[model samples]
Target chain A: MTDFAIDLKDVDKLYGGVFSRRVHALRGVDMRVGRGEIFGLLGPNGAGKSTLVKILMTVIRATRAMGTVLGRPVGNKPTLARVGYLPEHHRFPDYLTGRQVIEFYGAMSGVSRHERRKRAAELLDFVGMGKWADTRVRGYSKGMRQRVGIAQTLVNSPDLVIWDEPTDGVDPVGRRDIRQMTVELKRKGTTVMLNSHLLSELEMVCDRVAILVQGKVSSQGTIDELTVHRQRYEIEVSAGDSHVDAGVRKALAGWLPDGALEGRLEGGQTLKANFDSPHLPALITVSTADAQPVQPIIDALRNARLTVRAVKPIRPSLEDLFMEAVTDPVTGRTLAPGAKEGA
Target chain B: MVLRQTLAILGDAYRELNAKKMFWITLALSAFVVLAIACVGINSKGISVLWWTFPVDVFNTAIVSPALFYKLIFIGFGFKFWLTWAATILALISTASLIPDFVAGGSIDLMLSKPIARLRLFLTKYATGLLFVGLQVMVFSVASFLVIGIRGGVWDWKIFVAVPLVLLFFSYLYCVCVLIGIVTRSTIAALLLTVLFWFVLFLLHSGEQSLNLFKLNAEEQTATLEARAEPLSDQIAKSKAVIAQLSEAPTDETAEARGRREGELATKNASLTGLELRQQSTAKDLESYRASLGRLKLWHDVLFSVKTALPKTSETMELLQRVLTSSDETSKLEDAEQQRREERGTRRRDADAAKRDADNEADRGGPGFSPSVVRRQEEINRSRSVWWILGTSVAFEALVLAVACTIFVRRDF
Candidate 1:
């Protein structure tokens, strides 16, 4: 069995025929969304985020696609019963009440009427739309419509839920609630693929995220892994003289990994750890581009006859990674994937 | 499970149509219109358009059979041209947007994303659009039934045949609308094209009918010219033979032979000249008549083929007559009436023409009598079988739907 809720390889989608001006929406996209994880797809306006989500949801057809959803073949309708979708710019029938809209969609998903009613009530309240349940959607504000739209996405109780711009018109509190809801779904073992322009919202809740640039997966990994600068570590060495003993200095020289630090420790402060965390106060801070362990830094500080106040690792924010992934090197502030040059 | 989804989509479609205020308004107007038509009762005098009470005194209870009179009133108002037009156009325009709206991008995504098959969804949407026609006509038929019972004192439930018949007729045009709507995704464009299609069908049907009548007339004229020329050819041949025999006769002796030969030659010459003149005129008439027939035949062939290719639209609607009118008894009355009229000879006429005038006016939109006229209506309907008329129309609809569904399923949202 596949280890993913969705597994796609070499997926390509081109809008219009070859004779026309074809827009390549997705270019050889290979994606794996693991089971029971909240995966965010972050990208620009035409960056193929929505198109990718839609392909998984079977809302749009791919020109050349090979994949499976729910571990079955892609575009499988029976498997779609276990998948839910909320499209971007979705508009509900204006004549139906909010409750009716949910029930109607539930019915479309082959949910029993009684179950639809029960689920509608619970989901409407869950989305803070209980009061507006009986009101026609035409009179509801965009935020309210988004609330209903979200509630409807859960109507089928799908195992895999794909939401495109789920928090598009949502207010701040609603965005927070949506984030919380994503976490809750993850806890319940639901795999969610969230497509959103709200990078900050995604950063808060996403376990893993893939940044798409020009229809390609430029970078992808866990939030921590993507943002962390592993080579950089801060050793909080107190700025004092002779808090160190002679034996401790010798231990510091021996404890350091051979060639781990580029420069040697000398009588002054030459063989110190170079990188540090940005959140800490004035102390000894060490930074390096090399990937290494943190234990050595702790050991070195302990040997230096000074208290290791804090040994911290520094990392970039999600925005910094996103900018670095999407922007051109020459015209952009970010130097490269691993560069900390701008910061 | 497909059934449930079908029902779900069908239910949603129902709700979509039900949400329109125009549907209800049209229903109300139909009810009012039908009940208002039921108010009048016909008699020998004339129709009472807005009858509030039974004016039994104004009607003459004698002359025609009361049952025949009441049936005339029922059929005349119910099947009149104006009512058919109004019902058809109103029901069509109101339900025009159902398909376009269902296939609208966001809305269609919700449906197509379901486990339901796309073709089934499409078909159910079609059935849903048809539901409008079904409901509208059923209501109208029932009201007409009640009216016929209450006013005409004719409680024939068969009047309800109009329900399916009208639905079938309206579908002929509505199918074109649906096909256009799928291609264009515009409600106004669909409705306009459907109307235009109906106009073209009307022109073609009328053109065929008129051309057929002209062909029949030309054939009759040609036959008459051929019969008139036959005897003239015989007379010309007899005259030429006699003229030859006289020229061959040997000359006898003296004044008696000369005088007799001169008289004989003069008489034969006059007779030959007159026969030749009549024969020439007759031949020219035959040529003119045959030429007319040839032209009519050319047009007739073109129209007949065009008519055959199209669905039998008017005939499909006309199928209502088989159930609406009394067939057997009406046919006997018509046969006897026609026999009697034929016996009245060339110069003198009968009351049949006057009665026919009154019947035509009533059928146009009023009230009068004739069990005989029902035979012609029945004959026109029976020319095509139930299967032939309805089957061809449904085939047209199916072809269009197939094309639409193909476009719908293949195109990416």
Candidate 2:
């Protein structure tokens, strides 16, 4: 009955027995997801992300747990009626069509037939899967299956919808649609807790994010609060016109070197992974949270006689924050080398 | 509401059964088997209701009455091995996946995470598996019920008991399968283990039964020996006591008393000698039985206990024969046929088999004949009440299911 939809503390899960090699999946982790907020769990592979969710759903038994889900103790069957979960590696029974699968899961949640039928139609449309409703899930592509998975998650109109890697194998467009769906869910005051390796997608939709590293939540807060510690201001000084001389471009290049631009030295934490470096765009987005003021960079650009295109304050992206949280400073070893390598 | 969810699971599972064409194929095959059985029927006039033979035997035609035909088909075929092994095995293979499929990776989590309790989910799924066999047997049982009425003009409702009876017997193996499937979550392993367990149990039961017959024979032999030896033992003891008393009555007595005492001693000694001879013969006769009695008792206790602890599968199947027919009518028909054969003066070699057929029918829920005559057919038979057979077997199945459910609940998906 608390304001939080999920309040879990000191949940520990161990995978094996004594006298055997045991895997510590979750280590006395304490977590809470606020009602109506989009909470993203950011973690590497084997970082205990799915384990934590599975524990809450009672799919995997925790060695120890002190928690309540939807205001009831974890593993409470009735409370699960109000909680929905879409597993990370979920697979629908192939014999059933998408609509039947949706309805079957809906019925399992005790949704009435009339309501299930109506919500199925609405949810399929909501997930942009209206056309594939009657098609057997065996015929579905990965993205289409994800769409159906999302649609089924809404069958009971759960108050707390938890999805693990909801857009893992989805196409870019499907990922955007999923993000919009979460936004809609939040707008309607539904608590959404999702775990995804797609930090950019999570950043676009997550109001708050928890970065888990090696069976522990290393950092968690609103995206802005966590990223504000390392903000970057970029002075995109391009030759405003292509006709600008090569001398001007060369002088501009000196002001904006193709190296780590020093923002303020607040703890001097270096990023272990690049952010938004897809295809290495011409636009150099620099973060100023670590080093000097933004005004100097701009003044330097003006002094170089370069036409300043635009100067924008750049906050650290979730990927940067994730890498910083999970990466070792000295060795620069990612918490999950395997997880990163999987991609 | 929980019940509703259980129903939903049952419904969904049944629909999943439809997802595989093999189930329908199995159902069709079962129906065809029943239809084939239905084709070979007998009428009240003792003629084949389906068709007559091409070259009808003009002379010495056998009389096959409706009652006889119905017994031959219903109890003889339906209750014996047709529905027991053939139909039950088919039903088993079709329903083997019911459990494994329910606990299949992604499916189990969604179902278990629902508002329903895990025990309920497990029980409902278990019931759904039973429904697979129940429906199959029901179809066949009802068809047989119809054939009994249509061909023999008797709507014996007892014939329909095979529906639940078949399910009860099938459950003996399915429970084992479910227990394994819950732990291993592999259909082939579960099924093979169940079948292997059954074969092992069957062999154990048969072995015990043979031992029981031997023990019973030893018991009967001991009783016969003891009966004969009892009279001789009394006579010999009395004669020895009389002779001792007469000798001790000695020198204080008068001449007449001594003479009478001598006469009595002579009579007692003579009788004693006769009794001793008979006693020795009886004791010699009893020795083999006494020796075997000890060994037989030990084996009987071991076999009997082992047999009782396991589910009573043979007795459970026997329920079909018990409920579906009567022994009195069979024995009466047996007598009438014997009388008719005697009047005709033709002693066929099949007479012994016909006598055995009647005895076999009489063996279930009815007192069997003397042990000596039925040795080849002793067969570790029991006249258990329907309740005892069904109740004990169901109890075993429930116990197995309980253990399996506990494991399933505790284990992580």
Candidate 3:
């Protein structure tokens, strides 16, 4: 079995005074991401996403935590050497130009001077920021800075890339480019751990995702697995004039005892049905005044006389699945306090 | 790995220093000092009156004159300009920003994450500070020498040796200031402490001198006692010779006889034993006061010198001990011994003074002396005690520095 690219077992983080005050940023957070997978950590603000990242990076110590990354203990230097991190709101030294910042970070990762220069050039190009490499970071716009931030993260060519709100403040175009680059990195066998509030962007790219709520893993799995509760199936049919109005309805009514049907009549004769079911496979008996072959039932639907007018399924999106996971079962409020609707 | 880390830290230090405007200010100040020294050397009137009084030997005039002058001036300047109130202020200002900047800039996180050891980073930064101070001293020394050479025509190569010694002293002082800056993390507090220390030292010196006045009074009493112990035989002979000459040459017989009798009476009074003389001397209230004053003064001088020397000696010994002891050694044997010696010396001096005071009381006819003289004696004693306390405190500061450095090296930072 492939080793976990990132793993945290029973991690806890406590802040503030020993008594009278405390903020449990993380309470027994358990997470695992497989190698060569783009894993999205989706959460609203203050959902412990940043805390988990900091613990993994060793910037903040975790209480009662044990974990490993790439077979080494989490936060180990060797493991860090193979990991690239872009913080949520990091500010590079203003005095240093984009090229200089990249070179410096590359050097810190133990890259040779010549290789640092080479990699810096290549990474800047990869992030579509080659032209502005000589400009000081102080002068860069938010989008430009985000681009440079990405460029710096790739300088080490790390085995694992962790980006915290990487596309924050980025324009839509820049955000799309970043998403594309992330996918490209994953294609190149680099594992990406993305922490973001952008659920739609994550939905477009992440192979698997975990929703963190109130410092714990609320739900985690592939998109398809999480939404298995909502099942769907599509059916096609053809019919004659008499069968269209009465027979189709009768058949659908018999087939779906506790289901909803939605479709349009293609012609005077053809009909299509869309159904939602708690379970599948029901008996259907149809009687028509005019008889029609099974081929005509299918053909009429394809042509104007029997057109294929509708196809609908009961599949739930990643958003619906996420909401289901984060919604507290007791109060029916979001597990993340102050989480807004549709967020 | 260590070398690379050290170089990186040094580079950071150098870069930071270069970026600071105070570095330029310090450079400008050093240049000004050198120019001032040069201008003074160029103008003959600028030479101190004291320097001109030193007798110039014909054989050594060319070398010794300039060398001696430079040595004196360098030593003076070492304690004056190089160790100025401004230098400490600058040191405090510069070093104070070192750690705070790292923390504020978030550079500490980046640097600490490296494989480099934290203590080594600290040491490298400290060494950079030393180097900066050394450069300032060297610049001032060389420029001053060049000016002096051109104007006074007294260029002695030996004078250059003062450069490193002065630099060493400044470096040590700056190191101490840096340590203070690290501990207190306040530039103003560190500078205030440095200034306060120097002011206290000045106070101690003045206090010590005032205490020495009692010793001078004692010397005066001894001289007076010797003068009062003249022989009666010589006085009687002189008196008889003067009376016979008056009888023979022209004076009235009645007047001459009266003069002779008076002289004879004075001679009889002068022919007293040492014990009787002391008794007679103490009978006079002034004489008794002088005797006690003398005893107080003698004890005061001895105790004062011991008090001043003991701390300095102990300080020097402690500095030596610090140099000799490895950081790993748990026992500070030499430092403990030095402390013991200093305490013992102080106690012994006090005991000796007490013993001498007791003896003086026995020798004096009685304790009936003027209040003013006694007050003066007490004042002298008080000043001496103050001096000793001040000296010990100064030496204690050096010991504090040693301890601070030791603790600093072990701190994780």
Candidate 4:
């Protein structure tokens, strides 16, 4: 088993005063994320996803409970050194150029000046922002800024990277590039904690995911485990005339000797046998004037004695799993997972 | 590590100052102030009129060049000092929005996620504020000197010393405003508080001067009684009779007292009545005098008991020292050792007080200003424009910044 990079136990976060009103951003969340794994936190708007990320980063303290990242307590400065973060609405000094921002963040993380310069170039290139590195961030587009945000996150070469809505404004191409980069980061043994509303992207990149609804984690698991209940199977068959059916019945005597035949008339001189389970293949017979035309196997079935139906297959998708997890099984109102359905 | 962190913080502060529009605005304001002052100085008619109103004879000293005299006049009147202080504070408040902006924009998340400590970031912003203030002061001094030299044809190198002192004063104010900015997280609130503080200090200084005048007038009037024909006993008897008669009548005290008290009693009654009319005037004046003696006691204590119950400067310093020393376990031990030295000094003072009390206890000495009277006299003598400006700015900024930082650091943002 891989080491757990981030472990949270019954963490709860309440914002605002103790006597006044508060927003229960995270309610008893328990999460254990494995090392070198891409874990996606999927939720709708105001679903406590960002709150969880903030708690992990120590930007917002958990009102009650315990958590650790990379063996250090959450919010520990030394631990922060091994962790990189990109907030949902990340903004840098507009006066600073892309290169300067990266260098500044690198310097803040205690990276040497020479190393910072080299890494800044490399990261700028990695984010496909090599040309725009020298240009001020004021002129950069949203997608470009998102790219720089990604670069900044990797500047520390942190063991764990937390990204909140990293692709909110990113175009499809940029999103794909980031997804590829995330996969690459995972390959390099970095644990990525991603908080995103984009389910499709999460499905593409995440090995496992947790869905939050109404300030609590509704469900969490691998995609396959979540969708196993929705699996299905199918079969197809052909039919033949009475004479051929009688011959087929004689041929199938050994396979289904005692079972009563269930038949349906399709067209002239045609019979189709249907069985539920543990059924065996049956035989057919045909007659013709010429020796070539006397081939019964094809002529009997093609002449409406027996004919094969079309065959098709289906499999459950991530969307199907998400819908099942989010929706109420009975009323289908998208209730929280594990909540009892109202009769 | 501290030095490195300080440097990083300084860099961060510099970056923040560079981004703020107030930095430029303050620079422009400083230039304008210097230019305005230079215009007033170059026009001989304006200088002559201004000097005529002041009591100083430096204005008439023939040895001093007109330009040198004008520079001295500017320094003495604190035109540059006030301008720099006001402009720096205004600019600092505008720049104070830096941290709040970062919080609002969610950039703090990215920043805090780095290895740098939060305090370092805070201190860096403060240092950057000072840097901006320093730049503005330099600009103002250089501009004022150039304007004066071209217009008044005078150049004295002594004026250069004033530049550093002015910058130092501005730095003190800037540090204070930055501290306020860090604490309050609202530039508007910080700015308002700084301005209100300056106004209150001005009122206090003016109020103290007026009270001294009234005290002097009372003293002079009391002196006249000794020279009058009436002996001390007869006058005392007359004062007692007037007090006894007035107790039975519901007459306006001012008119009654004026009619009864002839010379010394009249002056004493007027000053006493003045004290009674002003809220906490008597207690405050006494406390001010005591504080003015040597203890540096604040007037707030005399005016309001409940307010005084809150933490005072010594308590705040203790808390600050505790926070710094206890930041790490190893440093805490070192702090304990240093605290021992301070205890020794306190013990010595206690011993001295015990010795004095033993010797004086049987005497039952009449009421008088305590032994620290000399210290008080010195304080009163030393109280001047520069001292008032320095003391007021330091106290006001320190309090503002401390409160601001505490609130901002603890706040959710």
The global C-alpha lDDT for each of the candidates, from Candidate 1 onward, is 0.72, 0.74, 0.60, 0.60
Q: Note the residue pairs that clash in candidate 3.
A: A238-A297, A300-A306, A301-A306, B218-B294
Give each prediction's DockQ, rounded to 2 decimals. Answer: 0.54, 0.53, 0.10, 0.37
lDDT of 1 by residue, A54-90 (tens): 7766667888889899889878878888888888888
| Candidate 2 vs. true structure, TM-score | 0.79
Write model 3 residue lDDT over B1-413, tens digit each, in one string. 35544554555466557766877788788776666554432122224332343232221233224434443444355325453446545655665555444433234444433334445555666677665655666666677567557655666454455444444444444545555666776666655665565455445555555445544455455555545545333454564565455435334457777677667555544543433555455446446657677676676666566546423322222232222223333123324434444565567567796665544443332253323344465444433443354346456545655665565544322
User: Which residue pairs in candidate 4 collide?
Assistant: A239-A305, A239-A306, A239-A307, A240-A305, A240-A306, A241-A305, B183-B404, B183-B405, B293-B376
Candidate 2: lDDT of A163?
93
Clashing pairs in 1: A233-A275, A233-A276, A234-A276, A264-A271, A265-A271, A274-A286, A274-A287, A275-A286, A275-A287
lDDT of 2 by residue, A51-151 (tens): 88888888888888997888898878788888888987787888888888888889888899899999989988888889989999999999998889888
Q: Give me the runs in candidate 4 sitting further than 4 Å from their true place.
A: A234-315, A329-331, A336-343, B1-5, B28-58, B63-71, B77-86, B138-185, B224-403
lDDT of 2 by residue, B63-176 (tens): 445645665677666666666776667767877877887788777777767778777778888888888777777877787778777766777887777777777888888899
Instruction: List the per-model TM-score of the A chain.
Output: 0.79, 0.77, 0.78, 0.75
lDDT of 4 by residue, B170-253 (tens): 554455445555556666765676556545544554445444433433333334433332343455456556655544544555
Q: Give per-residue CA lDDT, model 1, range B125-205, as digits (tens).
A: 887887887887787778777776776666787777777777777777777888898889899999999989888888887
Report how far off residue A199 is in candidate 4 (Å).
0.8
Candidate 4, residue A294: Cα displacement in angstroms equals 35
Task: Place model 4 in a CAPRI quality band.
Answer: acceptable
User: How displaced is residue B252 in candidate 1, in Å?
Assistant: 12
For each candidate, give the interface RMSD after superposing the true interface residues on Cα.
1.3, 1.4, 4.6, 2.1
